[model samples]
Target: MSMPEPKTAWRLLKSAGVKYVRFVIVDIFGRPRVDILPIDEAKDAFIDGVLFDGSSIPAYGGVNRSDFVAMPDLDSVYIETWNGGKTALIFTSVMDGSRPSLRDPRNVLKSALETVKARGYKPLLGVELEFFLVKGDPPMYADGGVYFDGHLLHTWPVLEEIMEHFHLSGIGSTKTHHEVAPGQYEVNIPAGDPLEVADKVLAFKILAKSVAQRHGYTATFMPKPFWGINGSGAHVHLSLWRDGENLFASVKEPREELKYAVAGILQNAIANSVFVAPTVNSYKRLVPHHEAPTRIVWGLGNRSAMVRVPYYGGRINRLEYRHPDPSMNPYVAFASIVFSAYMGVEKRLEPPPPVDTVAYELEGVRETPRHLGDAVKYAQESALLPEEFVKPYLALKEEEWLSYLKSEGDWEKTWNKITRWEYNAYLVNV
Candidate 1:
């Protein structure tokens, strides 16, 4: 996709009758921060770029070197009608001096995409964003609906409003349905350019929260907000294209490239866990028997495996990575998946035989990291990501893990159940 010129962006906003423009940036932890400007001031910001303190954001910079600029990707401009169509939002790229910051989550994914493009392939991503809506201080489910329930539940109207917002914002939301757990819902974003898809995923979360709040509820992407029920997952559907052909498609069985990509993902599953199942509470959702992936294995149409090749046949065939939860930073998660898959293709790595039956019942298959500390350790030992990114990410995650430990001493005893401390720490913030 080509980026729009500054003049084009200014004209588009003016034509839309936008009174305020929001310069949006995603921090390392996947939280979005915004700076809103009146239309007149924003016109100048489009050319000069918006300056902010990078040190305030996690993993960006130190106090001494805190200067940074947010250069809006004009093509990402989207007008929101919730505020009477007066507010326009644009996703920005963080700039360190004159160059893009490697620490910027979006730029990391951009670098990974360029690497894939140089090897004659274009990657496409479709994301399924799952989250829950609740109310009250400790949080309670807003509805009693189950999977595919279409009843006129309290949460249904919120989902409808969110979808309407997505449509107005140019996000292609293909499907929305009630998930297995109460108050849980999922929205499927159609396959598109990886970067655009990531932006939509982030936008979906923000919109869901906004719409839910207007209805007197809170929307959370927390992986495991409650125990003994299914947790929210951000299942990613990935496909690779070269010369306008789907590289993973085949008539009889799985293709070699598909197997190699799965192998690369499985090989780095341990290290990649930090990016996918990112939060301290994310590990709680990776356990078996809750429709979540626990084993690092792949199979055809197997939901239990971390990587499952959906039987779509022909050009539509793709892999579904089920390990990731909505708590992840989509930009970094997609980048890690692309880099791992590319590594497999470059090395010709072969995946293990497909698990035909229940993978959780099978022994000997490698299990994903059981805790955030284990994920941090595995990431520290691997060279999967660049040193600059990996160093700060590990430090940030390590601190998070230590804080969790401090809050709930002896995690081994309380790992099975969601504690009050865990709920207080992550329920609202995540």
Candidate 2:
């Protein structure tokens, strides 16, 4: 949906009996930070924006430039009524004084989208997010269901309630079902504008967690919450359009732009690893034979490949990037994908032949970074993303990797195990 005028949005909220307005901003770590004000005082906030201490947020700004503003995006205005309260939640565009902040994840994505638009292409993004629901202190599975299990009588009600909240919030969820592992579920969000798709992804996480808690369970997006079971992933599907025509459309074989896009992603897959798989536990899910992509390869409808061109044919054809997990910031991850694809088009890069067989059984293929430290190293050495974002992001993630080392010592020794420290650090927080 298009953005309404500020006054019109305020009036809509008031008419809906909204008692409070939530100004939401996503931090670099993909966590939502919110500030709520009564509906009566929200009119001014819509105009002038809300002020907050930016220094408290990681990588936002230092103490010297602590003041930041969150200007509400009217297109993102949605009323959340799941908690038995009328609250209008609006995503914000972060600002520093009179200009946009380079550190803001939303602004970073906007910048990438603008770059793509300048090249006469409109990028579309669809996301499939997988997560798990558990109960108890240490967190055990909430259900014993497997993939596509329809008779989850005890668990289907929770998913139905979550979908109801999504409908109320004006978010589109095309599909919802049990994932491969017990207590794990996947939600498919239809393709749309890149920024809007990212917003929907964030909103999905918030709503899923809220609904889970209300049902006496905890929802987690941690990539590898369990050691033996299948880990969760957030698969991203992308397509390029110009003059209302899909650039990657094809009947049988993939198109040139599609191959170029895949080439670009494979070229920078290692560099983009830190953004897609941001946490220490994320690498555990990337191991060989875990249904996760270990090599930087592309295939035609191959699930094991990092990038796959699903055999949809014609206008619906798109590239599916399978590396990202739910722990990532959608804004940053989407931006990186767009930028990489743009680079491919500009350079006319060609990807290697598509692998029609299992990529996991293949030899002599470039593997993804083994752990968070390796990803950080690759990110530090590469110049694929914006310098402003890469600098501070590496600093924060490097520290996180160091902390893991201090807490768990060597990760290789416990490579096959999910240590207590990992659960303590990432279980619910990620």
Candidate 3:
């Protein structure tokens, strides 16, 4: 069903009775916050927005900050899956009352989307979300099947329940299944314009978790809750479409199609990595042994490559960047991918030929993997991010990085491996 536009959000408030119409938006770390207003106050929030102090949230505005507005974006508005009688869920963009904050993650994504559109192609993003389902508040799924296991059929009942709700909500889900990690699962959603897809992502997560909760279970999209076992990743596959044509389609250059897209993604991938994998825990999922992308390389059907064209090919055909976990803010992450792809297209960057051979066994590229610092440097120095960002990106995560550094064993995170240290401590810690 078509959603009511922002201009009409106020109409919904005026035309219908709403028991609750609160605005929900995520902070820098992808944590959701709500500005709950009585149904009566929501009318003003649609246009004038609900006024709130910006100093309350962590890793956000300064304590002595000025005013910020939660201008509702009805375009992003979604109804929570289990609405009782009077309340509904919607998302908003935090504006400076004059203009949206460029520092705001949502605005950062919008800026990138605008840039890509101006470049002549509309970017389409498809995300393959892999997460786990547990039985309790922390939640666990019914099976222990690992890595493309077929036990998904066992959970079909639960999957069917969730998918039915999504279909009714006009958010189409492409597929769902068991992942490699025990009890881990994945859901693939249909592709759409970046903003629209991001909206679905917000809805998907809420519904996914809520449905699981209702069934006496719990769900987590966190990147690395298990630490050593396989961590979840929201690996996104992207391609450009203009006037109903796939810009990344290999049809025209077939051989070159694969290489060109790969080169472009790698060139801009590092800078965009900031958006794709934003949190400190995100780095923990980047190790080579964990099926994570550690190097700047691409290959066909190789789980280890940073970029891979999954076996399913066509105009809907595209490259999948497997590095991003669920920790990223959907808006920023999607835009970042589009920006990188635009840079790739404009520069006509040619990827090193597809690693027809195994990428792990391939020679010449650096053997050790790249770290988050390596990626931060790339994005920080990139003309794209530097030009559009509101401030030095370094100032963005300094505190979080330093905080993680203070932990006893986490300090050597960048250049060291966790398991390596554990092996060295074996039986000698007495």
> Total clashing residue pairs per candidate?
0, 0, 10
Cα TM-score of candidate 2: 0.97
Report lDDT (Cα) of residue 323, candidate 1: 94
lDDT of residue 378 for candidate 1: 93
Report the number of backbone clashes for model 3.
Answer: 10
TM-score of 1: 0.97
Candidates' C-alpha lDDT: 0.86, 0.88, 0.66
lDDT for each residue of candidate 1 in 1-430, tens digit (9 for 90 to 100) = 5777787788888887999998889888877889999998888889888899989998889999999998898767777765578988789999999899988888989999999999999888898888989999788889888999989466778888887888887776567889999989998988988888888787777677878889999998999988889999999989888999988887658889889999999999998999999988999998889989999999988898899888654333788999999999899999999889888887889999998798889897789998999999999998476777779988989998998888888779778888777777677666
Model 1 spans with C-alpha error above 4 angstroms = 312-316
Clashing pairs in 3: 133-140, 133-141, 134-139, 134-140, 135-139, 135-140, 139-218, 147-180, 271-379, 314-317
| TM-scores for candidates 1 onward, in order | 0.97, 0.97, 0.84
Q: Report the alpha-carbon TM-score of model 3 versus the true structure.
A: 0.84
- Tens-digit lDDT track of model 3 for 201-247: 77787777777767755566766555567877888888777777776
| Model 1, global lDDT | 0.86
Ten-residue region with minimum lDDT total, candidate 1: 309-318
Better of 1 and 3 by TM-score: 1
* Candidate 2 C-alpha lDDT tens digits along 93-205: 99988888878999989999989999899999998899999888677888999889988887788999998888777887467889999999998877999999988888888
